[model samples]
Target: MSVHRVYLPDLGHGDFEPGAVLEITGQEARHAVRVKRLMPGDVLEILNGQGLRAVAVLGESRKHPAGHGKTEWAVDVRIESVAQEPPISPRLHVLACAPKLTRVEDMVDQLSQVGAAAWFPLVTRHTLTPPKAERVDKLERVAAEAAKQCGRAWTMEIGSPVPLADALSRTHRAIRPSARLVIADPRGAPYSPDGSTDLALLIGPEAGFTDDEVDAACRAGAMLCSIGPHLMRVGTAAVVASGLILNAEQPR
Candidate 1:
């Protein structure tokens, strides 16, 4: 089995186990303190989201007088035990567009679910939503949660948003002599990679790519690949292409 695959929070310190006291913090803490109605002595599973599976018993709830309406806090009462994790494989990066609102969130959530190496949100001419750093932060949180839940060995890296041209350049630099680059062009012919050293798969936006964008991407080192008969949404194409890339690289 793979090691406790949870991103961030370190999950260090503490001898985690049954009867151990732990405080839920941040949005997670808020959910537990406010929404869950968890009171003092409430025993719950305190997964560092890393699969430690430490059973945590909540002590008394305390409020801070230092700050105004200071949020609630929890303290772990006891320590149960701890466990180490196994190793996983190297990651594969997923470079894609910000598909606006629900679509973007869904993509972020799903990509992390699938164990992507990293996420690069590109700003193409067809990009309608200008994603703010705050929005990307939300994406990061979502990925972290997904990683914890899905037991991913490493957290997916959320990269800064760059221009499509810049993304093309990055792809060229990322590819090895033996590695291949494939871009999803609905009208392009089907051609898969030769061998997997590492891949930087590109997925375009809803309106797809302009002729200039396609030409630039091709020049930058991406192989034009088709999705067969029908056209797919940028989001759908991303998920599908990601699956294809990972599956193709996997040992048969």
Candidate 2:
């Protein structure tokens, strides 16, 4: 059976050599002990979401009383091994317009699972509801949980909402000067991999992008492409586009 996984954002803080003992506290510890019922000798995988992964054997759990009459849980785990997973190739960054309600949360989870390097909420002309700070926080949490479940060493980054122009400019900066820009639209040609290691995909809102927005994107060097035969909601389109781009066969 695959070992259960937990996220430890501070896994890089200290030495993690074999046989090292690390105490897991806070929300993660509580979840492992209370919810997972992890016991002594149980093996688990811990990820730091920055390419660091550790295999550890569970030790004992301890509880401490708080002043407010609540108890906090902590668990000790003995490190068995540590490894750094390399980032996936053809890094995909998704910039999708915010969908209505909680669908954006689901999109983050799915994108993280599918190996998207990051997600940004695109504030397009047709976008009606941009994500708030609280929603962004929740999206981060969702990404973390999805990373643990999917066994990805690194978590998908959640970027703040940005306007279309800003989004284009940010991706064109020195960091990813070679990043391919793609916009999903019905009028574009079929999607294909161009073998660019870095790619930014834009998915418009339900009402779709305005002509001016499409013109701006094309002017910014974004390729207009169709992801599927039928129209899809914001979340679905993002996932489908990401999958196609991430899994496509690149030129040898």
Evaluated against the true structure, the overall lDDT of model 2 is: 0.86
TM-score against native, each model = 0.69, 0.92
- The number of the candidate with the highest lDDT is 2
Tens digit of per-residue lDDT, candidate 1, span 73-115: 5433444555544322334666777786778888878887765
TM-score of 1: 0.69
Runs in model 1 with CA error above 4 Å?
Answer: 1-71, 75-90, 171-179, 188-197
Candidate 2 local lDDT, residue 241:
89
**TM-score, cand. 2 vs. native:** 0.92
lDDT of 2 by residue, 1-252 (tens): 678897987658356888899888888889988998889999999899999888999999999775699989989999999998878787888889888887888899999999999998888878887888888889999999999999999899998777888767765332266788899999999887777898889999999999999998898889998988899999999999889888883435
